[model samples]
Target: MNVGEWAAVIGAAGSLLGGGGFFVARATVKAARATAAAQQAAALATAAPAQQAANLAVLEATVRRVDEENGALRGEQARFRSLLRAFAWTVDRWAGQMHRAGIEPEPVHPLVEEYNRTGV
Candidate 1:
């Protein structure tokens, strides 16, 4: 072939090679990205159950702590109610003594009356 024709053939071959290399490189990069994404998804999938289990454990611990706190509060409430009842009894006994002595007793508190009525 003539030198000019040979040069033209070489130019065409170079252009095809360059374009094909670019396409191959682009395809390789795209495939690598997809593989990385799949790996990340698999890792997250494997970890999800462990994460959920940890969350459940934390929730159970919190519930147990709250229940214990509620139990302590109930004990305190019982003690307070007993003390209030004792106070009410003492007041009633004093009022009876005052009445027997011909002295007028103070009026009963509304709260004490409500507590007696509701047992709350």
Candidate 2:
């Protein structure tokens, strides 16, 4: 072949190689970006359910603790009420003894009558 024609053939081959390399590099970059995005999406999807379950567990624990506290408070209230009733009965008995001994009895309050009728 003539030198000019050989030079043209080599130049065309180099151009084709350069264009193919550029196309391959662009395809590789796009594929890598897509893979990274897909991985991020999968990780987020997996983490979301775990986070929700943890939140639910915490809420359940809080509810259980509140219920236990309420039960304890109720027990304390019952004990306090029993002590108050016992004191009221002792006061009434002492007053009765004082009346029998000829001392003037104190007037009964309405609240004391209600307390005598109901243990509360």
Candidate 3:
């Protein structure tokens, strides 16, 4: 072929190849970006349940602590009640002795009356 013809043919081929390569490079970039976005979404999805489980563990620990505090409060209340009852019994005995020695007895306690009647 003539020099001019050969040059024209080679130039046309290079232009076509360059244009096709540009399109291929753009498609490759888009695919890589899409893959990266999908990976990020999957990572977030996997972490969500773990976060919820961690929150549940914290809540359960709080509930357990509260339950322990409530049990301690109940035991303290029982001990205080027992001490009060012992004091009441001592007073009742003293009042009875005073009556036997010539003083009138005090009226019975309503709580004691109720307890005697109901067995509580």
Q: What is the lDDT of residue 93 in candidate 2?
A: 92
How does residue 64 of candidate 2 score in lDDT? Answer: 100
Model 2 regions more than 4 Å off: 1-45
Per-model TM-score, in order, reads: 0.74, 0.55, 0.53
**Candidate 1 wrong stretches, greater than 4 Å:** 1-16
Q: In lDDT terms, how accurate is model 3?
A: 0.77
TM-score ranking from best to worst? 1, 2, 3
Alpha-carbon lDDT of model 1: 0.80
Per-residue lDDT value at 14 in model 3: 56
Error of 2 at 74 (Å): 2.0
How many clashing residue pairs appear in each of the predictions shown? 0, 0, 0
Evaluate model 1: give its TM-score. 0.74
Whole-model Cα lDDT of every candidate shown, in order? 0.80, 0.80, 0.77
Candidate 2 on 7-117: residue-level lDDT in tens?
A: 456556656887655555555566667777999999999999999999999999999999999999999999998899888989989999998999978788888888888
RMSD after Cα superposition, model 3: 11.3
